[model samples]
Target: MIESPGILYSIGAFLLVIGPLVFVHEMGHYLVARWFGTKVEKFSIGFGREIAGWTDKRGTRWKIGWMPLGGYVQFAGDLNAASQPDPNAGDASAEERAALFQFKPVGQRFLIILAGPMINFLFAIILFMGIFATYGQAQNAPVVSAIMEGSVADQAGFELGDEISAVDGRAIDRFDELADIVRLRPGQQMQFDILRDGRELSITAVTADVTVEDRFGNEARIGRLGVQSAVLEMETLGALQLPGAALTQTLSSLEMITVGLGQIISGRRSIEELGGPLRIAQFSGQTASLGLYAFLFFMAAISINLGFINLLPIPMLDGGHLVFYAAEAIRRRPIKPEAQEWAFRMGLAVLLSFMLMVTVIDLGSFGLWERLSGLIS
Candidate 1:
């Protein structure tokens, strides 16, 4: 029997992770719609034909789709409920068509658009805080662990066991904080305060220009001060520790998204850096192997990504609708329907193109074609 590509296994793994994550995202929109006195028509866990579902007393149909790409929420009084174009709209009566998104008041529409992303952010915070409150956070004491051969850290005369006290006079307590400052430049020189033996030590590390590939096959020559943390010394925290930890995680997530976007836009990174479902499964399986702690962390990161992607100001996206609503609020009138329609079309095209590109990368990353071609070759 031919090997299954571990396809089913990966799919199961991804569904375990993404199904709940996407539900949380869509629920953010759904709950908000209800809060605003709008009726929800459907709450789907996946898209396409409904394999399993039910209608609640509230008259909402909850179903799972055949294609498990992602989930969505459909508000009431709308044909198909999403931004997708519907040929069925042509046959609708004038009153039916009148209930279209474009006909909604700008203020009402703004809340609906804003809710999806807002819920994502809220979920991230809650997850982070929950994790912290339950298990606590462990951090290293800003000590250098390993120095990569020929890396910037090695060349900067950074010896192992040098306890980094600060970066640019900012007292550094965590390795993440140090990484944030270090990765900010590829060739920039920064001051480092270290505690060596018992005395304070002052040093400078010139970030070397080096290229690294991200999760997606994007190349970036970044300032490489290649250093590893000594170890994760377990430091348990009290219940009050959750909020702070949540804030820290939030800032870190924001920094990552900002840096990734900047690198992609600046040509320092390539578009091939994007990965879709397949990649998630690969990582998810790996994370599952590492056990619960790592899996939770991975899920949290993915949650942050979901939030960030939704917040981007693109048509058909939560952010895109918010932009239009903002414009309407300022001008005291809705945007021309044609403009909204055109923007939605363009956004859909861009999103699909990106999805296809990511799928390609996923296939390559998994070496599907390469292995097959090698057999033929």
Candidate 2:
């Protein structure tokens, strides 16, 4: 079992992992806005009161805020960090109009908002590229070495030394790929293509729904086939192959994330499984203690998640702004300021409520509720 390194260590590790990522995300917006000749009023790395700050030569206030949850880049014509367009944006002087974000073309505005999430995906790819280039990629052949008695695989007629060629017509080259497909598909019937004694055969099975606990005592419900593969192989990647490998890995990670989110939305996964900032800190601390490679891998995974979450089409998010721009492009007119304001308010409410729910879940996962009940009793 893995033990947490205490609260202080977790907080420090969370900041170290999240700070650079937040900077990278905001930088994408800052650079893209500058490229479009828009004036950035502030580039803060966190929210709430500023802990420290300085003005750049270009008149941008670069500051670090007390709250390290997230950051924002506020443009000159923005009402706030959420980038709600100012109602009086058109009242700017002739010179100021050129530097205001609200005055930019709809296409430019879409791209500026898109850049933040896109850069995050790009950053994850770069990190994966470095990792693959340095340590190579490990692959476990999808050949079964053992099967549990009366398990799903055994009940499905799986035999020792049987090679899994495909699942549900999707080709599988690695054991982990098969595991991923199964994990996300609890209680679903799946067709497995098998190569046994040089003959191709098909078998079907209903995956077993199993609840497993991580070393840190977090429990997750997933599909299990009750098969094992011990034959491991490492493929050395060269400079020419790094990009392709990295892109493939990134896409695979994205697929897993999307599937997990789909499960949660479909009620196949519990909402209590959702984690917030506190859980992130716990993971950051745990991964940091594992080693540099472990920490970097966790960072890359979180970066992709951050990018994906921001692209969700909810108001007050980058995707929401892109949606507005799309409407403006089609209608040849901007969305009404009043309508956008109401949408932002609704979005803020939804976002905060979601945060609170996840925070409560995090506290419960830490046994806070159990301890409180004990005290009261």
Candidate 3:
């Protein structure tokens, strides 16, 4: 095992991953707003005092801020960097109003707000597709390498070297597909079609519920078939197939995350699995040590996460803006500024509280306090 780097190393790694992501996400909004002819005043990376900047030919002040946590784009009619509409935006000249964000059509505004998350998803898909195109897809077939003694597979007569062809009449070509099918169906009976000794046979067995700790160290009960994969192999995909494969993998990963979250909400999974920036930073360094390909894969996964999180309907987020736009569309007018202010304040509180909770968990996971106490002793 590699020795753990100090806290400074983790902080630096965290910045490297988040900096580009924040830039890309904010740029998505900036570019789309420009396309819609809205006047962008300032495009700043980070939230505090300007560290360095240059005004573009288009009259946009692009700058880096002292704080590197998050960023914003200030539009002509914005009340602040948060993109709230200016109170006097409606009273501007026709030409000025035409170039203002708030004066733009609702459809234009919606597209501009939606572009951020969409770009994140698109960026991940393109990255994955490129990676796959360069290096072949690592394939692991649904072939069993072992059956635990006295377990469901052993009781059902499953043997080593048996290849699973289908489950409950559904064809599965990949090991992950088979595993996923079983993992979500604990206590349920399944009909399996397998090829053993060059002969196809059918077997039925009830899945076994196994309590296991997830990657984040949260315990959850999932189904286990008492089977393991033989080995991992790589399958090359043609140029034409790369996009399709990349998209399929992206959707599958997203679906798994959605289901996992649903389980947590439904009391099937533990909420302790919810991690903060520290967990991400720790994993980032670990993954970087693996190889460039592994690191890129981590980036893609994080990109998808960023996209999904921003699309959630919480105040002070991109999704929150979309929600406001939807309300405006339905009511045939913008929401009152007083109400929007309160909502943003509440959203900020919720996000801060969540960050604090996860940070505490991260410290515990890292054994920070334990190590400190040992030093004191």
Top-lDDT candidate index? 2
lDDT by residue for model 1 over 1-377, one digit each (tens)?
22223566656777878888888888887776777666677899878888999999988899999888778887655545454434355576766555444455668767776777677777778777766766666677678889899887788788889999998797878886787767766677789999988889888877877777644343445666889986666666666777777877887887778877797788766666667987888777666655677677788888888878888888877888788779989988767767877888898898898888889887986788799999999
lDDT of 2 by residue, 1-377 (tens): 87868889999999999999999999999999999999999999989999999999999999999999999999999999999988888888989999999999889889999999999999999998888777667788999999999899988899999999999999988898899889888898999999999999999999999999988776888999989988667677888988887887788889989988888999988888789999999999999988888888899999999999999989998988989999999999999988999999999998999999999999998899999999999
Model 1 TM-score, all chains together? 0.82
Per-candidate Cα lDDT values, in order, are: 0.76, 0.91, 0.84
Q: For candidate 1, what is the total of clashing residue pairs?
A: 2
| 1 or 3, greater by lDDT | 3
Q: Which residue ranges in model 2 land beyond 4 Å of their true spot?
A: none
Cα-based lDDT at residue 197, candidate 2: 97
By the TM-score metric, which is better: model 2 or model 3?
2
Write candidate 3's Cα lDDT for 1-377 as tens digits. 35544567667766777788888888999999999999999998888999999999989999999988778889899998878778888899998999999989988999998988888888888888988877667678889987889999999899998999999998888888898878876777899999999999999999997888644344557889999886667677888998888898788668767877887788766677677887888777766656678777888888888888888888888899999999999999989999998898898898889889989888877789889999999
Global Cα lDDT for candidate 3: 0.84
What ranges in model 3 sit over 4 Å off? 5-9, 160-171, 180-224, 369-377
Could you tell me which 10 consecutive residues in candidate 1 have the lowest summed lDDT? 1-10
Taking all chains together, each candidate's TM-score versus the true structure is 0.82, 0.96, 0.86
